[model samples]
Target: MSLPLAPGLAGTRILLGISAGIAAYKSAHLARLLKKSGFEVRVVMTEGAQAFITPLTLQALTGEPVRTSLLDPEAEAGMGHIELAKWADVILIAPATADLMARLAHGHADDLLTTLCLATEARCLMAPAMNQAMWRHPATLANADRLVELGWILLGPDAGDQACGDVGLGRMLEPETILAQLLDELEPARDEALRVMPVHRDLVGRRVVITAGPTREALDPVRYLSNHSSGKMGYALAAACAERGASVTLVSGPVTLSTPPGVERIEVISAAEMLTAVESRMPCDLFIGCAAVADYRAAAISEHKLKKTEDASGLTLELVRNPDIVATIAARPDRPFTVGFAAETQALETHAGSKLERKRLDLVVANDVSREGVGFGGDDNAATLLWRERERTRRHTLPRQPKTALANAIVDHIADRMR
Candidate 1:
């Protein structure tokens, strides 16, 4: 999903600091994504990160030569470190490794990255990436807490499979996810302080399930059919709900979107797989069908690639309709407050209204995909929410905003309805 660029970061200068860790590889992508999101990115890499990724790669992505050594004589002209430090609007450190964290905690300015951090007054954002054990270490936690107290933004050590072949916490957030978080921080909600100060425990203990992305229907061993669903909306909803203290379970189709912090994500592929996964986690307080499930799948599976024969003029494969997952869930006796999405080209209200009634959905979010810039695969979305009664319906024409912002709005509406 495309996120609306915040004025706070657009054309703003950002100094990206890369440190040593397995997650350094992600820093390259993060730098590129940041540049694409309209930040002027300058990369500063520690010697350790250079061990894993090339300075050339980061330079290519940022369109600026990578700065590594603190002692480079040419770079030191006119007090380069201090000058670069003063030039930044924000200093973001990705893969802020355990070693770096310790150094930063104690104000150790041994390297260029650390020295720059000490020299700069720019807002700092750090993404701690390390082994799960290292992340949980008492010293690391204390240092991180101290950093947070000092007004540094901590992005994530998201829970998931780590490069160390162990699954738990301590995974660096994906580039797009980090970019979204950065946007959120830079362009905080107009009423962010007020909203956060209030405790809306309306969903304090509620279990909410959300599905996201486009399901892949395998056509062969290597080929598959999928839609343009980016999973951005669903992931954003998950994050929003979690922020509201809801226990969120995200049953996601294949997408590059990262699982929101504090969300339990169950990854699946085909529509059938999604169904099985959701059903296994049923009896929740809410179920959101945000994924674009494939309508049909190959009727028969082929073990190998079907080769063309000399006499064959063409090949036709049969297809069968995939199960309607949301409808089936809504039909259950223990169904949660069901929400579905309707993406239409024409007669959006008419079609979405029908779907709402026919599928027994408590709420349906309808979007006009036919319009430019506001639907399927785009970061921004404009939705007209539909319910049984016309008076109860509400049309929310969201500005060309981030999908996460839209998701937060949708979740707020849902929470209000639940209350």
Candidate 2:
């Protein structure tokens, strides 16, 4: 399914400046992505940026002429640099080199890109990309701090493998991430509302193990049974938990989601595999079985591939119950604060209450997947969080919002209780 876009990103004017770095190649893809996402994208290249990537290539991708020089008299006649700078709502510098960053900090405008950066009232954002050593250098560090102090937004210099074969910090964040940050910049109110939520490092030193996504029950070698779970909620939970200083281990089912930073990820395909994984990460402070593990699996396996019968004979196969991962964990003598998710189509509160009692769960987050944009494969969700402790039952309603925000709220609730 196509992921939803940033609010108000469509038709927003964005000025993208490319700098000298191997990561410049990524900016080509970034330009194409922004344009496709409905941003009015324009490209500016420094002389050094031109060396790494051609102007024509960026021009073709942006569907507009690329600007490169500080002094092109013909273009200067119209003061094109100033015009372009004024046209932008936000100026994004990707693959922003240490040199460029230093120049920006010191108020240098010797180049067209830097000149435009000064000429505009538009918001300025930078994504630093360079060698680990360069990124760590005291000079670069000071420059970065200065930029931040001057109200210039600096995005990630993510740690990963670099082109120079050295490993450490200094990889530019992917285009998708930069785009998300871009949205946050464009819509500060969305971010501000999140900041008011009650969450902190209250889970520090806690160990959190969460299961996410849909478990696949194999019917044949090539086919399986799974749900419409995108694993987004669980992944968001993993991220939120980590952000709260918890040591998070994510036992994830088959899903195309990236591991949250600083979280350990365990990939499993089937329900049985999921149970084993969750059990192995034992004695954690919390165990959240957010995975949509299949209730049953094929009772027998065929040695070879199953094929359709041309004679129209129907085939039947036996099925068996899969292990109850969350219940089993909750029953452990050293059980952590167990949390489970009930993505119900009907009677959400009733089913959630039953699950909480049946599994002896500390909490159950119940959401009506039947409601559009609330659960399953969407970006947002709403839920009724039911709790049971010492025979007392309580529940709180989580308002409809982004899964990230909802996950934060869940984490906040758990953290507040634990504290």
Candidate 3:
């Protein structure tokens, strides 16, 4: 399953403020990186910073005109500062010099950047940069603490060689590091917002049952057979469902992942146990079979660990077919809107459609596991959705994306189809 193309930073707005400091030079690269990563970047330079780097440099890098004043009548006629403040999703102050930190900490709105910081409801993050002595100054430390107490997220003034011959803390983090941290802070908020969107919130108050990971088929007392399913996909589905306010029961096989928030998790080791768990939590509004269940198990159990014999003859064990959990549930008179997963290496749609019909599933998420980032242990996936529309089978291709993103899309689709 090859996911569709995505602009990683589309619709995300970032207001970048540069304060006076030699490290202000780094803001250029940061602006460019933020843009490249899908953020709408707008740069603001403090008066003192213009001496270190030209506004033209940042403006050119960010593709937006630089804003550097608190009282430009032409702009102020429309209360442009207020508009700029309201437009930001996050305000980042890189190269936040000691003086600038103090101004913001004391709630000074003397400049356009500082004024916007005061006006905007967006989250504020500062990356302090200065000489070690100045950085270690008690007043500076107090200002930093004050800013932190005011709900400002302060990124590192990392320890390293300073521009001033001396070496210690007070170096600005690399542009890449700042971008990664920025995304980490904002992505959760974005996901949370998406969770409540009217279009994506259809699952609210609905009951969902999701099975994930691989079941172990016992071969002997100390041996068992299992696939490479890491259970990440199923876990993501559970989390996505919970985010949409669904009452979710995640029947998970042996995996190291934590239970998703707002989800009830049932841990099981074998196919029989998994089926038992699913049956007990039944009468769900939706059932998603994402687990990679072993098709067969040993016909008989061995009380002791099987050992190699002196003759070295290969051991032979009889096997029996395991219960088809998803099909059994779908066969019920009061079955939920049943869904299943098909991880295939070849003929993906063909095999997936077959499974959808064979199991009588309302929807099937078919993944070409052979594609990179689609299946197994990875944090990302790409999938094709197969659902019966009257007598025809409809397919939708979802591009490769983080598992959480894919899960949300899938859940939204399920909701739409149900409606």
Candidate 4:
């Protein structure tokens, strides 16, 4: 979301630092996203980062001249690093390489970026990206711990497939995820601080059950059908609820996201498994069905992998309807306040309203997934929340925003309704 409407971050200055790594390419997008969010962004690049991505690219994206050399006589005539350092409200190093992290931890100021880091009093944040092995190394771990102890915030070294054809932790978070997290960490204006108050424990005695991600429909032991659900929204909701002191149980489908702190995560694969898991966590105060459960699954499980026949031109498999997880829970006589999500490509309101009534849901969050930059596998989302109040249906519209922000707003609404 753009920060223009946010009092504290409206004109926030961000010093975007890029270090050497394949992930440096993502820094370009990071710069753009920050700029789009109304943050004044300036970029400083390590010499090695220029090898992977050029300063010109970032300069163009941020609309600010990029700084490369620490001792460029023309720029340093005014102690450019110090000036840039003083200009920033926050210093964020994306693709903070292992070498850079080590240097930062040990007080090295060898380059413009590192030098600015040393000269800046602004809050320091890093998004570390390196080979999985390097990230897990004893020295790297020590440096990371030390950086945190020194008041530096570590964004993520997300786990997943890497450029080296090996998969594990060490990937930098997506630009949108980084932006969302940065906003969440920053304190809003005092008058607006209560909007996302840290000390609030409004859900202290509540129990929340949330389902997230895309359920896989097994076609065989090796193949399955699933959607492009990253489980980000659901996980965000779980985190928000947990932060508010709610006992949150997250019934999640296969997704790579890290479990949020204080949340109980139960992993499952198929829609049936998710349904069973949710049912087992029943009798909760609130139930949020956010999973993209497949509408159909293989009607019959094959004993072995199906092989293509030389004589046959094509093949067909029978499919059957899968159980409607949210509807089933809502139908229960002991149902809690049930919330459902309707992710539609078209006629969003019509579909969502139908689910709210047909499934007997307390609320239905209608999402238009066809929109770019928000929905499905992305880090941002927009929705129309529909619910029945008194004798008529009421709706609230939430503009496109970081899933974390959206989740917080959704929870706040739910809390208000519950009260």
- By TM-score, who's the top model here? 2
Worst 10 residues of 2 by lDDT: 1-10
Q: What lDDT does candidate 4 reach at residue 106?
A: 98
Candidate 4 has a TM-score of: 0.55
lDDT of each: 0.82, 0.84, 0.84, 0.85
Residue 132 of model 3 has an lDDT of 71
lDDT comparing candidate 3 with the true structure: 0.84
Misplaced by over 4 Å in model 4 are: 1-199
Candidate 4 or 1, higher TM-score? 1
For residues 1-61, what per-residue lDDT tens digits would candidate 3 score against the true structure? 1111134546678999999999988898898888877778898888999999999999888
The RMSD (Cα, Å) of candidate 2 is: 8.9
lDDT of 1 by residue, 274-335 (tens): 99999997888899998989999999868787777778588888999999999999999999
Error of 4 at 152 (Å): 24
TM-score, one value per model: 0.56, 0.57, 0.55, 0.55
Q: How many backbone clashes does candidate 1 have?
A: 2
Worst 10 residues of 1 by lDDT: 193-202
Mark the regions of model 2 whose C-alpha exceeds 4 Å error after superposition. 1-199
Best candidate, lDDT: 4
- Pairs that clash in candidate 2: none
lDDT at 119, model 1: 91
Error (Å) of candidate 3 at residue 97 is 47
Clashes of each: 2, 0, 6, 0
